[model samples]
Target chain A: MSGNPVERLGRGTTDLVVDLGGLARFAGRVVVAGSGRPWRLRRLLDEVFGIGVLSISIIGLSGLVVGLVLGLQGYNTLVRFGAENSLGAVVGLTLIRELGPVLTALLVAGRAGSAIAAEIGSMVVTEQLDGLRMMSVDPEDFVVAPKAMAMVISMPLLSALFITLGLFGGMVVAVGIVGGDAGIYLTSLESSVEFREDVLGSLVKALVFGVLVALIATWRGYTAEPNAAGVSAATTSTVVASSVSVLIFDFFITALWRV
Target chain B: MNVSPLRDLLVGCFVLAGLLSLAYLSVTLGGLSYRGPGGLQIHATFDEVGGLKPRAPVVIGGVKVGQIKSIQLDGDLRPRAVLDVDPAVGIPVDSSASILTSGVLGDQYIGIELGAEEDVLKGGDEIQYTQSAVILERLIGKVVQNLGADSE
Candidate 1:
């Protein structure tokens, strides 16, 4: 019976596909339940503080490092062509479009994604999720909505913070450290770029990534089996799924934008 | 029929609102760079785009005016990059396209250096000249190797 290859293959493929379908439905249900809750205001507060308010320091520090690195690297490249003035736009545009979104998603995946998986997985193992169902209360409203809403809301502000911090970080390295003229750099960058386009793409990516991360983590945790073993799996799955999902969506969005 | 569609409808609205937040953020963040009131698209081509990704900005004079819309290999096996520029900033046809790196280890994007030519490049115009991105690490290695040879 254990060596039944045909049965194993059939079961594995069926479960994989079915799991994905079930996950999609579960995600939809989460959104619905979250919205229908009377404590929507409270949920919003938790999301903002947990996802956005608390993440400021890390996001800021990362932005500073990236910006400084960009400045240092950019100076070397531009000095060769004698077009060193292009540094600000390079830093600004890159942060707005690619690094800002990618980094933020990664950070959130680690912090929030793992947390979601752990929270839900623990709940599942303890029978809390089932208890809610038994009591006719929607767990999605009480759980999923807060996390998802927080991500969607806080991502844009975080992106902007990343951009602003990066700009300053680059400023320190370029102007203060490298002796580049700050006024000239800003003027050139302002004349050449707009904040809206750069920020818009990041906002979009973050929002989507947030939702995806929430979905994956919550699903893995909520549907986990085998108790403690399931928690470990859920945690791993949440991080892996969030990271992979971000990269996949990044590719798709990039492709679509190009079109 | 006996149950309430009203409950389902309420749930739907909540979900919709959450979705809208995502969509709204995407649109706003994407438009943060050079954008006109009404969005517009422009096109450009390059021999080598390097590692340029989509949503990569179309910058002129170190200012982003658009984004790279698509990239494909031409009949000559050259990379042809399509750009989406804001309608407001008019690019002249004789403008030069160069693949420039943001820094030592950063993403590459095509830069349009506007020419002082009397006629401005309109929509569907091609940038006459192109320069591919110059990687700093490669350049530095070459410089160091040459110096080592001199010392030897």
Candidate 2:
């Protein structure tokens, strides 16, 4: 605590590099150890249910609300330029290309990511991870891997649900509430959105976000200081780290895709 | 924890539904329809196609009739666009084709103007009257040149 400022800075940089290296090792172990035997189908299913099914209401509701808001705002702005009919295009493109994956990742990070960190952190505090190590059982496989796999599998599905519900919500606001022609709205949405650029791009983004969220959550939890306060801190770190990484990665991915 | 078959079933169904809906949305909303009615191809040549690309909508009187199938350079090095118009849509032989920008800063599409002719165009027919894209920069340059001349 009494070190020179430059020394402190240098120490911090070394700590960060070491942390990143350890994380990469942990992730590698999860991938390798998670693939092998006693294929835990039951555990994977439970993780999927916990991660995917439970988050549906929040994801769907937010998607619908976001879509509705987009429709309202897009209509108001487009009408001035006599391009009101293109509201569908605006809403569809926004949801599929950017909002769908990004928002779903952020929400899932808040919900599932924190839960993962907390659960694993509590287990660590209880010495369950140490017990597995003592028994020569790989904790990465038994715990982290299943959850990571579940998150990977569930993310794209959730993103699709978000986009689907969002489109319906946009339609409700645009056609039902805003007095826009339903036919035109549908047509414009169909004509403007592309399968590869928008839909696949979103799914790819979701996949990347899912991996980041799960890995960050598990990593923080696995490395927690053996205490209740440590578990809580890890959970908070999961949320903050996942959210920031999602946004930063999103910018890079979007820049790469240019969509 | 007890493994419930019902829960597994429900999870499977949910994932399946989500995937199916995604596929449906991508195909329908993305305009990747494959089982639609048959269409006929018509060719039109232009000096400059600008940013117009294949798959851009081909509209008639503000209604979409088909899409641009392909664009290739002709003998004179002009851009020739092949449009795949729906068979149901009958374009007159004397009709004109022009590249139009959707909005101020939007994508470009092909616009077909109907003509009063008894004979309707058949497949493989050429649209003789075609207008190329209007380059915004060139238009602004011309306007600026005119303004400068007036000031002098």
Candidate 3:
């Protein structure tokens, strides 16, 4: 009442609203950041660290299993109708459209998204965020920006890894058990799938999910009012938000666009 | 000072090599042949193509080399499926083309059975052998009956 509309110091009703405000401000800020900053540094880290290094094993194993099962299941079913060759069409479409993005998002959200929430949440409880604010820095620009940048930049690449690995995985199934040629599987995947629109459509969806993920985790974490419980809440919110947002976006995009 | 940076570098390189090689192996293995690439062009006539789409995989011996190029009816109204075969595969003219399901409740694709004929089929040639899709529910019912009988 005496000084400002709402106290900014510790945690208050105003701070909770500020947390919401910070999230609201992110849309415009991110666009500006995207256009002006271009995120090259973040992209490099995301590629090397977030996607290329950290994600390979999980994506590889997941893709392998998915490929094997698809091949076996597809072959068995086709044997009855004697339409086994059409296996390419089934595997290709499913890998590109459905399993690719959904599986990757879920896996990565479990892996990376949660980690991000916990790390940032830890910072908030430790007062590193408040320290930055005291030094005349916007914690949003300092803490939230870099990691959010990393997530947004890397998601499409991660999604690509998920999808391509899935294809490879499906092929293993195709070759080892289903008894299909490997070269033929790649060809079917390449030709049946239109690259620019269809594959790109999935990648674009991943990018959107990435951005949503970064925002949700950063918003939830960066504003937690310096407490152990707050950190936990932030962590839970990050996972739920990222997973829900990925699914909802997937459905809407699948319905609305040809991609 | 205890351990040289060169030693650390060696370890890093070793790790990197292992990961990259695995990734490469998966790529090469997964790069194996995909079906529906070559001469299986479609010259079929269907009352309704249903969900049948062009460039769909046409499989033979569980390999897909060509696709459904088009579907249209003939003068006598027979469902004519024109196939394109890889010149290398040497599909005999007597081979039969059947529309088969890929999975239990999956999409339909053309299946080819090699015919024991000397002469081979040409680009525009149609295979006389054909089998259509089985109604899924009926097939499941058959399975249930088979299972029940086996139990008895």
Candidate 4:
């Protein structure tokens, strides 16, 4: 049993190294493929529509609800300290700095990242990817590149929508419900939010999360075993990996880029 | 796959709207403006700036009339702040500049108290009367010293 445990540990380490190497090679190939003349704009738009536009309602609604909740809770706490006037600053900073990008990325990972993995996994299981290879069409370029580019373009835009709607939701709760002055809330928000720090940081986070979700989803799908169960597993793994990584990277990014 | 131009157009509009709103929010909420309301540069020297940062608002009667463009040390090693005030706001020659904390324990900004004078200060003019930032620890120490002296 002791020998078996040691061997399993060694095998796990080796698997991790091999997986990292595969991911690096896949990233390299995607970079090398580059955006050539036949820019595949149509395919890219289709992916953007599927990934960004379709996810808007879900992202926007969640942002609104979350903002309202933050305002409600913040008002209750701040009133105790007679600082209720700062509700806008609290809500705006939280949404802009942390919640907006992180929540949007998670939603996109669940909705679009899983879809990417499942679609590619299905292609792999059905041997469609192999068929493309037989036709001398590089599968990464034809299948993955456009989707990845769409994600990179769509994430920051979606995050901006989330933040904008979230601010309105916060205003509704803080001003309409909590009896705070709208002018004070707005002025405080304006004074507190910094463009170079909060806005730029949020966009940067969204961009990184977008690239990560696409890469992980595509890698899992591309390497999926040739079976129906493998496709489902790939979809599940995409959601899990993308969500966890977004959270982990958010912490590091916040620490590193703190104003 | 059938490419729908209508769908693409709608998506493009949605993205463009989002981006425009983002730009608006960053500019308005972030208090970022490029054209500085056509201002004139003025200077004030303070013994200490404390927690004051560059770009801090310059307020008069609680209204933001300008901003601190930069802070540098003069030959005497005293910190001097360069303020850019709206040309519409004419500061009298005897006006005083003071560094003040916003709220109870908030960020520091420059506050200007207008003085009555016949002559109005122009661009490149330096305000003579100035006050430095009040350090909280120093205030507490003074309070403690007063209490000790009373007990003695």
Reference contacts reproduced by model 4? 0.65
State which candidate, 2 or 4, has the greater DockQ.
Answer: 4
Best by DockQ: 4
TM-score sort, best first: 4, 2, 1, 3
The C-alpha TM-scores of every prediction are 0.62, 0.81, 0.59, 0.87
Report the lDDT tens digits of candidate 3 across residue range A38-107: 4554333432364335766787688667866786787789779876666666776776677777787777
In order, the Cα lDDT scores of the candidates are: 0.73, 0.90, 0.66, 0.88
lDDT of 2 by residue, B83-129 (tens): 88888887889999999997777789999999889889998899989
In the order shown, what is each candidate's alpha-carbon RMSD?
A: 10.6, 5.2, 10.2, 3.5
Ranking by DockQ: 4, 2, 1, 3
Worst 10 residues of 3 chain A by lDDT: A43-52
Assess the local accuracy of residue A176 in candidate 3 as a C-alpha lDDT between 0 and 100.
Answer: 73
Q: By TM-score, who's the top model here?
A: 4
- Residue A139 in candidate 3, Cα distance off native in Å: 2.6
lDDT for residue A72 in candidate 4, whole number 0-100 = 95
Off by over 4 Å in 4: A1-3, B34-42, B60-65, B70-77, B84-96, B100-108, B112-128, B133-152
The list of candidate 2 runs beyond 4 A from truth reads B34-45, B48-51, B58-66, B69-76, B82-152
DockQ category of candidate 2: medium
Each model's DockQ? 0.07, 0.52, 0.05, 0.62
